[model samples]
Target: MQTAVGVFGGEGYKDGIEVPPLMVANAGQSDRPEISSLNCPPFVAVELCREHLGVHPCDRRRSINEYRSLFPAIDFSLIENDDDVLWKADTREKNEEVAARGLKFLSWLWTRKEKEIAIVTHSGFLYHTLSAFGSDCHPSVKDEICKHFANCELRSVVIIDRSMMGSDPATTNYPGKIPSGLDLPSDVADEKLPDEGKVN
Candidate 1:
């Protein structure tokens, strides 16, 4: 089976306010304007998988629950776990760790031979994780990634069969694709006070 992955950026945030309506608009669902974050809700993610990935209904619910449980608190925050050895590492080390983790995840998923696997994560996660695939890009591009991915934008990476390791034709890399989508609301965008000052 062939496997493909997609990475999407979170919603926008100015200061600490969240633009509720914009967030809904970006998800291609304007009727539900109550969404407060860019990370797709568990139900939505599961629906997407069912509709697009053709996962079984039971399997989709289980996957959604697993994902949601993995990150119980989904508000904006660093991805590193408290026990992660690279938590205190320097910038280079941190980036390397992120990339390693991303590759590892991909490798595991590829083993399943699923047709498509989508990862909805923050911009930093995507940038650092996928840095290994990017060549000769500007240094600033990495830094700007944190800002540019401020909105709920969808980006996809297609790894054709040829690109897989140990395949008949060893294709090392494929062009990373970033798709366009509407803007989402951010907690920071709709807030009047600074994020730090906001009461949880």
Candidate 2:
């Protein structure tokens, strides 16, 4: 995740990168103060995101924050208050619940008017969350990005339903789902990129 963000722009990075400032799409938005808080090993997605984000305590060179910290990048504002972790995963959580949360997140992004953004995430969880947006991919960009993102790879995508993005998405405000009978379509998903044709 950090690697993905770093590629856009970070300390020690040369100026004139393509993307805009990065925002992390954490696998599980748990704000645990220590690894012990996680109890078991930091699950696959958690571990990988920490590794690249420079927040993992085990790897000093890679770690920037203490543990499970996303400072100097993802501000506290983006996260939910208290221990109500945004994307925290739970064993008892139902797939429908997960899908609802994922859809709400997409809607939140839409509310923020985020056209293009960066996501710091791992494979399994990526699919797990994105799959909820809809069963299928948006036809136009699907071919370009394919099914999933490869290791530390980059791709661009567009939202299909444009409604799924409604914190709980506006679409839910009224009706028996879209006319298609599917939740608004969205892609698994970038950081801030400089305005094109502009010379820095």
* Cα TM-score per model: 0.35, 0.41
The total number of steric clashes, by the backbone 3 Å criterion, in model 2 comes to 15
- Runs in model 2 lying further than 4 Å from the true structure: 11-70, 81-96, 133-146, 160-200
Candidate 2 lDDT over residue span 1-200, tens digit each: 34443454343333454322233334226432211111111111222222211223322222324223543343334332333332223334454554465555555555544455655655534554555443243443334433666887665545554344443343223333444433222322211223433577
Candidate 1 error regions (>4 Å): 1-93, 136-148, 161-171, 174-200
Q: Compared with the true structure, what per-residue lDDT tens digits does model 1 show for residues 88-140?
A: 22233345555676666556556654576566654555666556552433344
Residue 65 miss distance in model 2 (angstroms): 8.3
Worst 10 residues of 1 by lDDT: 46-55
lDDT of 2: 0.39
TM-score, model 1 to reference:
0.35
Give the Å error, residue 185, model 2: 17
